[model samples]
Target chain A: MSDFLFKRMTLIGIGLLGSSIALAARQKGLVEHIAIHTRSQATLARAEELSLGDSYHKDVADSVKDADLVIVCTPVGACEAVAKAIAPYLAEGAIVTDVGSVKASIIRQMQPYLPKTVHFIPGHPIAGTEQSGPDSGFAELFINRWCILTPPEGTDAAAVDKLAQFWTVLGSNVETMDANHHDHVLAITSHLPHLIAYNIVGTASDLEMVTNSEVIKYSAGGFRDSTRLAASDPTMWRDVFLHNKEATLEMLGRFTEDLTALQRAIRWGDGDTLYELFSRTRSIRRSIIDAGQEVDASDFGRHIVEGGETRAEQLKSDDHKDTGS
Target chain B: MSDFLFKRMTLIGIGLLGSSIALAARQKGLVEHIAIHTRSQATLARAEELSLGDSYHKDVADSVKDADLVIVCTPVGACEAVAKAIAPYLAEGAIVTDVGSVKASIIRQMQPYLPKTVHFIPGHPIAGTEQSGPDSGFAELFINRWCILTPPEGTDAAAVDKLAQFWTVLGSNVETMDANHHDHVLAITSHLPHLIAYNIVGTASDLEMVTNSEVIKYSAGGFRDSTRLAASDPTMWRDVFLHNKEATLEMLGRFTEDLTALQRAIRWGDGDTLYELFSRTRSIRRSIIDAGQEVDASDFGRHIVEGGETRAEQLKSDDHKDTGS
Candidate 1:
């Protein structure tokens, strides 16, 4: 392994984010020793079985002792408890960070318990999947994805730089913003999309006229796409909505207003209005593709005819027909 | 290539659906001669250039003359106009169908114009990508997908069987339902989803506080999934909403009510409600996968690591880390 930047790295929740960090850190040789801790004995045992860290600790304080970097990887609802549990044993000069989706609330809940000696840098890696648990993690989860660090003002610049370096080493493109701003941005970008997905999927499933079986059978027509986000961890999302309440509500309000107008347009037979809104959204997807944030895979890249061929070749042979009457 | 099902098959619009039908029909040797017609001479020339049909006709009537099977593959808004144009020329005892998402409205628009000798079955294939136009058509577009045919109450059973068989040959699993039921089913499964996608994408783009560039750059955090549907053809989607107004509005009403409750849950910090709703939606996604409607591809199956590897292998290596704190 390459020379380590830190003598020890402690992860204070060996779940998806924690285990992923451990695996990523170990893969990159960023830390000499990795300590993993979770509240549950079964999960600690599971982490141990997976070899997610050098040491598996049942006690939260024990996990943070002597670590140069300690990352709290938990749902936002649990951040305060984790902060209080680990405060006394944390090493001086250690950088404290988190992988929670909400930032301002995490900062609010955590800052009180964390000692002044440690540098508290709140972070959120814009990466994950619907699957969960220690076994779900892989070293390459964060590769090329953005890991946003939302460090409070007056936090040591050196500590922030070190944390950025750590994420860069783990293959993330890092960006920093204020914790409140991060919460607002994520409310629109991540939280709202997830809520809408869950809402629509739930609506479809609960319909009395449309059988749940039929909804599933014919989901290839648009509904299935929303289900991916809906399939995400419920607890994590629940915690997200609870902690980021104001911002999430603000974005949700805006979304509902827009949706209502759209509903009206459809109701009134306003095809022009509908067409304009639909046309405008296409450019955003294009921008995402151009910015390297998304792959230009049509139908979630599910190919009908499998062959040893490039997408270009496949598109050439399987040309699309949009031009019409 | 193989024994033909019909001597001539006329496609009344050479767009995405129409051209795909042409390509698939040609590939399966379902028809000996494919006559494609569009009002736009430019589109007709382009269709000719793509060789999407045996003959490209500017006159709609010329395309349907002597054709045993005629398919109207155009936007729903154009159904009445196309029906009127092709009614006089449709061969006696010919089976005619249209692939439009909203079947009830299309039936109302076209049925009165269509001659009694021709069987006008309204069909909708639950298959498509966001990409459209003549160049986007593929021979395998409908492979392993559902195609719903909404026949009128007194439609000739023999004619319906022939049309169903034609779709089966195109690699679609066929189902027959009444026009009104089909509209309701599709509004939930297809129309509503597209509207939500478009609305959300538009909301993100219209946000003044969040830069469009930032939204695009960080779209992978669930927003990009919606964008895929949002990027679909505006004209087609507009027609869907306009024609299926009642069903779309009903579904939209249900969706809005659910969303309002969800918004309240988030605002009031009712984590249990949020958790339960989120948890419930996951099973629907699983059902979709189990029922062979969706592939279990995490993150739309976008592979970051370049390789000559199958998605199963990629998923195996990228075993997701969802289970954690």
Candidate 2:
């Protein structure tokens, strides 16, 4: 076991990301001493209450005084302030990273504030849920999920490798990319999907003809799925959009344009076009299933829809005839 | 038990809707014998393989003979043909209903072909799975869902009452409404949601910049939900749009206008408008929960994003709760 890879790990903003790291670290035995800190005394106290760390502090300098690693886990908008707050605190030779959803902006915001001796490696874990706070995280949230790290030029390779190991122990499939590319990919994969969900749910709620009760009652599977993303922590998401405005806007532009094409197709009464488009989309669902990220939950999850046969039956036939269909 | 409300029930299509009715009727003992008929031999055989009915026939006329109730369960496009085929052989005083999604057009197409001896009532069951065919249904699929009945003027009260009781026995909440209005309401709530889901999935699949693996690997709760709706049977949905064109087009127009406004807001970085709209939608999810129609599957049956009530409890007292206060 590469357990106790670090003697001490300091965390800022003991919220979802921070607490999840703590749990994963403990379970994986990655570090000996977990130092949890937050700007709010209340949050710090809550993290302590949750037993999320061996040490809790509201002062970053003192918290990082003897730490071997420090991870900033705040809303993207607060990176600068946190970087400033902890600049003097990040220890020499220590690798400092973040678990923000937006990468480029945080790198820009934190680079200037970091001490020269500390290695600043920015990361965005492409994982989360509709909930937030210290209590909302688990050791398994990052399992099989992607974590992209954007290290600046001249960053120490050994330090980057160590941080990557930490995330890998936490069950992340790590990808190293430039900060810009990280933002761009996330804009399409994570950020824009979230924005669209929130927008559609908002649109549905505002409709005069469809009462709120009706939307809820007949939400079926479609609306329910949209709402899961829509139900995400609002403050965290709002800050993400604000921080990653350019990338998010670019993706949103593409999505809206595609949607407009669909609108036009519907307006023209083009059944062939609509059918073709609908058919193409159905295949993506199969791809998602093949990747093991999702299963066919069907509507209402009332029943698992697959026949649970074909392949197994094929194997049986192969054994019986040593021969073919 | 009000079971055997019909002496013999004939279902003209052995797909999802038709199969569901067979299972529900069998479970509730709602009819003496279920007579299944479809256009294809394969489906008829599969229905037999699934024990979907006590009686089976390939021809509609032979299937409906001596039946006390007939359900035109084929695609909406086939309703007129099914009606024409079954009308001459139906027993006197039989009540005919359809499980088509679009009510107005189904009534228009089938009403003229039906014999005056049989009562004609059209219905839309606001419940389904992404799966189709005889083997895809269960007895409990209709539980706690809705069935909307659209009957033309002077349609017998006795006939409507009997159909409502049948749906009620199947564990659905039955509501009577005008055919046109049923189509309009469903256009937004059902049709549009499915269309948008299919469209977005298709759009995402076509993007040259995003790999299928990337979309699937990070496919979160949102995409999974959308895909479930998108994966619905193609022929059924194609006919739905083709049949319910006017109302769906009208609702699609409204959705497009709203979406465009949202696009503009995002482009201008209008956080207030975006936040306001987002905040409003959360209430709809709550209502859905209250109505017992949905569960919060945010962790999505994977890792519980966080265990327990810690996150939700914290949000109630969240500092941002005072934002804009």
lDDT leader: 1
* Ten-residue region with minimum lDDT total, candidate 1 chain A: A304-313
Q: A55 in model 1: Cα distance from truth in Å?
A: 1.6
Cα deviation of B76 in candidate 1 (Å)? Answer: 0.4
For residues B1-325, could you state the per-residue lDDT of candidate 2 as single tens digits?
Answer: 5547888998888776788889889988899999998888888888898799999997778998888888887877788888787778878889888888888888889888888887888887887766666666667767778888898898899999999999999989988989887777777678877877777676566667667666776665245557778877776777788888887777777766777776677667676776776666666665665576654443443332223333332332223221110
Model 2 spans with C-alpha error above 4 angstroms: A300-325, B1-3, B300-325
RMSD from true fold, candidate 2: 5.1
Assess each prediction's global lDDT (C-alpha) against the native.
0.83, 0.74
Error of 2 at A232 (Å): 1.2
Off by over 4 Å in 1: A304-325, B304-323
Pick the DockQ winner: 1
Clashing residue pair totals per candidate (backbone < 3 A) = 26, 2
